[model samples]
Target: MKNLIDYKDDIYKCSRCGLCQTVCPVYKATLNECAVSRGKFNLLNGVIKGDLILNKNLKKYLELCTGCNACKDFCPSRIDVRDIFIAAKAEYYKTNKLSFKEKVLNSYFLFKLVLIVSRFFLPLYRFFRVNKLIKYFENSIKKMGTAAKWLILLNSAAGNGYKPKIRSGSSLKKVLYFDGCFNKYINNETLNSVKKILAQCNVELVTKNFECCGVSYLNDGNIDEFKKIIEKNLSKLDDDFDCIITDCASCYDVLKKYKDYSSDPKAVSLSDNIKMAWDLMKNLEFEALKSYKISVHKPCHDSYEFIDLVKKIKSCEYIEVKDYDKCCGFAGKFALINQNISGKISEQKAQNYIDSDVDIILTTCPACLLGLEQGFAELKLSQNRQKPEIMSLYQFLSSVCKISD
Candidate 1:
């Protein structure tokens, strides 16, 4: 919960290197210096010295970021750009009144209500082409000057009810599995795949009732809600397990931050045990399936360990795209809040995959799956080209391991 003032030194550490311009997805999309870290840092520095005031324009400039941490990684000084932006966003929200739509979207109760309603009515909605109705509603919401178009897009992309059955195993090594909000509500096929693969490796998997990792809340500048959910998750996550596993790269990133965000001793232990499911799968011996060329979309939070695992699969041919490590422009809420910029970036990534002529496009993050899907859909309409199937690394590995559905 550090304020912008707390990050003054970190802000000044930026030497206006402009190296971030080369890696920043939003900056590439908008070509606005304010969209990059160095530019944002300069504005923030001015705010600290009372030369500039925090206004709607400044807030919008900050919101332009995708929270991919690319600038932080590319910085010569290794300045923490994401931390500063997040803190500044939190501070901005503290003084400003949240809009009705923002409050409703970030409310835990409303989220639960929407999840329940979607699960119950999604089939009917899909059958009836509810997106048209949503579009009509969007017109009204837009008239109200709120960004409800994101809600419309999200509703259209909602998955059909696909819950995977959880299986247990008897093994010496104990692992707790954290199914992120996307896996828990929209799709569980990937979670089931993780369980099947882990069972094959003789690792016992444990399940618990965990809340959203608060990454969404943090992105929305709802710090209070984020803290509330984190405390709840920490209470449920005890130190009994040898490792806490997640297939979602975003959840992995957020869970690892709990150590710095909280004072609870379990927070550190839980963060320390946060392991990527693919990291475990890489070492296990498995018979690779029949050969198929595949391209990977490495998630922003990924350490590329999953890419190495994909390469190890026996008969499969791995095709590398030129922008393999670039952001898919779907950094959670970033896709929703900044759809135009997000769509432009996704188009670039998707076009790269389409040009590769790979049979499948693989990624580790569910959000990326949605983003890539959106991109392919847009391209398919414009170019009328045959698009490759987008699958999760878990799904690809499950197929290679021949795990039954």
Candidate 2:
């Protein structure tokens, strides 16, 4: 878990090829050389060589990256450029303590405390139009040059309800839910839907006493804190489970970072398990999903091995959007911190949806849902059109298939 800047060999191995430019979403939006992997590489090299100090201005350039992993996927060297950037941020944050906001975010106890308080103050948010108030607070954070965003988030927990908790039965098939912070807070419905889908599959769910998946902490470059959270979660999860389920791609990707699982024989995302079960059900001549006109936003974390599943389902007329594998701009903190560039990448994805002529836009992760929904909102405003509905792949499946008792 060394700082990404510490990857001298990987950083030095980068040939400044600029091949990452073709697919980098931020670079496409801002058209700034500094927004892509190569530029960031050069900047980090300067910092390492003492040509540049790791200051806020320099940090902002690194922060502009979405950590979408697109660059690494395309890199000939496969240098893991995204992880390096994340490590660099962690290294920088080590030298520079957490900002007032980040300090609150990284603490589980404080976050839960804020959630408790939010439950009591729910009406106040509703009375004043909370979502707009949140946007106002986000804007205010920018205007006042203060850490109001974290304070606002502290107040806004009840707006989405508390971090979702799953109730488990004593003895049955167990499933672990990797509820990343965002899914716990914003996309509670998907959590609920996952429970329902599990019930239909006859799999009993278990709620592990776990911490956040550390994706946020990892991106913030608080590696030590991130490691601590993962270790704590690993200690709590001693029971056996059929599989681990999560509704966020970024969280799913980060969960794999845990060395504790290096020994576990089985671990898979909820969608992955479903895709496997889907094959079994298909062999049974189960009714195909016929009512929906849908398109899938294959998350970057979903194995490319599953792309054949897409091909299999394609015969049912499930529309596939072009460039669907590209990141949806929900790289945790990236969406919040780099709004304009993030929005542009999101708009492009939304535009693909509009052109696809589908009733619903489907994705595997909750963050993608939020990012795409926001993009659809922007597109609607621009064209005076209504936005398409956003749905998790589970919800889409649950809607089409009836659950048996």
Candidate 3:
């Protein structure tokens, strides 16, 4: 792994342009230059020059980022801002001793344990409206500590751990399906939909004992753990498959960037074969539906041309929302760390969908689904209006393909 100083040139490559400010979700919410890429770059540059120390404040600046890559995407210089931040985070973790709370939150065993418990109690949790309960718990967790906040967020995001039974097809082209953590646990409907859609395409969908994509580890600055999980995942996949497909945009983005973080040859191979589920299904034949007004919340990590593909669908009328490309503010642990900002951004997105007056609000990312759902749920209580149904693109396509859940 490269150190922060190794990316000295990339850090300095920032032209100090403020265009990132316009698109940065955190910056838009906080209106703090320190929350944006350029400001962070300046701080990083200061650290390199020995003018500033990698202290708590400096670390907080890095944490303020949602890692959405919007700044990198909009950068005139095309600097990999997210990459630099990740490197900086790794360096900080290396030099500083992690608090007990940080260590516990980042523990693999604890995460898996929480997942197991959450899955077991999912029915009861939903019955009590756990999503609604999270808002109230947020304040108390903040008062407790950062560790509590992590626990609350992870609990809130836990899914029912439903596994869809996907029957194999007779196609020679084998596509390995990587059901990301969110889809695997909470949103199995999306996975089932993907399987049915792929079956229609005459492609064999394969699955093996795969682990989490280690995105949460990466976001939490646990690079060592992230690499370990990625190595485990790589061992499960082989070159025999035609392509590796993922429905979650964030997972797709992280898988695509695996090569940059790890030197493992398999990481490069795995990333090379990664295909966004929407990219594969858009060209396939499906029965068109009656005209329905639909709005899309494009995930910040969306790299494929899914929106254009959605537009190509004949039956559904795509309603355009103002600032459609804005972040839904569910940047993994970011929503937990900065709930106020996250809630504000999510509410703004929900308002856009409400204003569009659509029958359904569709998104490509699983985490975005949670954010949109929470936002719409809050809107329902406060505004007393009908909240549009939130569905994954896979769900929408499944309906068009007439796949029963």
Candidate 4:
């Protein structure tokens, strides 16, 4: 429950050296000084000194950030820009009640509702060759609109018909699986893929009724709601498990921070066990089933240790494209708030992959998956040429690799 005042010293620590401008994706895309952390810090410093107002317009400026933390990582001050921005947003949320339209548009409940409804129709989306149909009409669909383009890409990914080998093995390590909202509601492809791989490794994949990782709530400065989700998730944990595993980078990032928001001592213990599923796979071996070229889009919040493991896969050639570590520009709600800027960043990123001409573009976060979809949708593909297929790191592996361990 720290306020913006708590971040005053952090704000003033900004040296105005503009190094943040070099790493910020939004600033790179928009070239707007206000879009970067150093610039945002300057405005915050003004507000702290009582020279400016923390008003709605100022909140809009804060919204420009994608919560990528690139600047925070590169800053000499090591300022936690994400937390400062959240504190500032919370300060505004204290007085600025959301309008009904804003509430509905940003509603987590509605977002879940949409996913639930989509899940309901998943059988039909797949039964009728929805993915192939979309592929067949790619050029025409591109003209429908941006949302349509993103829909086709994301939906095609889930139903893309890549099947992993079903393996049989005995259980050994006990790990609770945190199936994120994307895997739980929209599609189980990633979850199913993880389960299959772990099964081969003789790992007992435990399940629990864990809730969303509260990443959206935290970034929006809805700390109250974020804390509720964290506590709810913590209440589900115990010492019976060796560790907690998640495939989604965003979920892993937020789960690892649960201790920062809660007073219940269990939060610390559970957070200590937060892990990417790749941790278990690091010891296992995989036999490559394809000779395709592949590359990865590292999620902003990912542990990212899996990159080396991926490169180690025998037959898949890993091509390191330029700015492989840059943001995909779909920092969750940041996309909704700044669509033009977000699209520009994502499209620029997509062009990199297109230029590399890799067969697959892999990522860890579901939101980043959508950002890729959004980016490619903005492109006009050459006739008879399709963009590279997108997949979760594990999802692609499950299809192309078998645990030889």
In terms of lDDT, the best-performing candidate is: 4
Candidate 1 CA-lDDT value: 0.78
**How well is each residue in 1-405 modelled by candidate 4, as lDDT tens digits?**
578998888888888899999899999988999989988988988888999888888888998999899999999999999989999988877868787865775576887788788777776777788877887777788789867766675666556544566676667777899987777666778888888888877787887867778888888887777887887787777767768889888888887788888878888877788888888888777767878888999998886688888888888899998777889998887887788899899999989998998898888888888888888887777877688888788887787776677
Off by over 4 Å in 3: 123-169, 288-290, 377-384, 400-405
- Rate residue 70 of model 2 by lDDT: 86
lDDT of 3: 0.76
lDDT of 3 by residue, 1-405 (tens): 678899999887788869999899899989989999989988999999999988767888898888888888899999888878888888888888887977886798988886667556766776676755775555454346445544554554554333444566577577889986665555467887787777777777777757788887887667989988988898887767768888888888889878877788888988888888877776675445677787788888885378876676666788888877878887877876677787777778888888888888778888888778555543433334566767788877775434322
lDDT values for all models: 0.78, 0.64, 0.76, 0.82
Task: Show where candidate 1 strays beyond 4 Å.
Answer: 122-169, 380-384, 400-405
Best by TM-score: 4
For candidate 1, write residues 1-405 as lDDT tens digits. 689999999888888869999999999999999999989998999889999887767888888988888888889999888888888888887877777966776779988777667656666775686756764454344334224534544653554333344355557687899986766665567887787787777787787868778888777566787878889998898768778899988898889888877889988898888998888776675545677788899999879877877776667788998798988898877876787888889878888987788888888888888778656544533334556768888876765555421
Encode model 2's per-residue lDDT on 1-405: one tens digit a residue.
Answer: 565546988888888888989989889999999998889889989988999888778888988888788888888888888678877887787677567766675776886675456445555665667755665444334334224433443333323332223345443565666655544443355666566656554566556645677777777777777767766766766545556766666666777666522333332223234222222223211123565566778777765543454344432456778878888876657877877777789879989978877776767766676667655544533334445567666555455444443
Ranking by TM-score, best first? 4, 1, 3, 2
Please rank every candidate by lDDT, starting with the best.
Answer: 4, 1, 3, 2
